[model samples]
Target: MTTLPAPLVWTFDGPFERCLADIEDTLRRAIVMVGDVSRVAMLIDLSLPALKQRVDAGEALQPAWGRFLERMARYGLPASPRVRHLRGAGPLATLVIAYRN
Candidate 1:
């Protein structure tokens, strides 16, 4: 398989909504640096239950995620990409964006 370029990594913390805002801000900044974005790898550091709790508590920050995904879809990336959960010693969440160029 062809290897994609190293992604632009973005770390997020604090309240879920705040974190999502950070992601959105970073994504906007990244566009300036990397041009158009095609794919993104979202790494959630929290476990499934922890994530569920955030979602149940209206803290999943779906709006930010939705906006990001919507942007990706406009770039021709599939609306439903394969998602995987990984455990790693990193920030609470990380968004790795790959530029289309």
Candidate 2:
């Protein structure tokens, strides 16, 4: 069996308010760099309780990731984020943005 190489991952550690801008900037730069790419996956790791609760409540992800999604849409990148709960590191919420060809 052949194992695929890991996708590029960016970590933003800090309060959401403090790190949101950095995350946005990084994502924008990445989208620009990967122009016309065959595929791209942008995964977001959010482990905050507040965010987790909001997601769990079935509230629109817009509250948490609206801005990012909006930006991606502007670039003609539609996002379908799959949320997963990672148990190892305190209730972590993972959003995987998979871009397909």
In order, the Cα lDDT scores of the candidates are: 0.55, 0.51
Model 2 misplacement above 4 A: 1-6, 48-65, 90-101
lDDT of 2 at 28: 66
Candidate 1: the clashing residue pairs are: none
Candidate 1 accuracy as TM-score: 0.53
Q: What does candidate 1's lDDT look like per residue over 41-94, in tens digits?
A: 333343345455567777755676777567545544323433445554444566
Question: Which of the numbered candidates is closest to the native, going by highest lDDT?
Answer: 1
lDDT, candidate 1, at 85:
52
Model 1 clashes, total count: 0
lDDT of 1: 0.55
Per-residue lDDT value at 52 in model 1: 58
lDDT of 2 by residue, 1-101 (tens): 43323454565544444355566666566655555433665666666565555457665554446675555556444444334444354423333434443
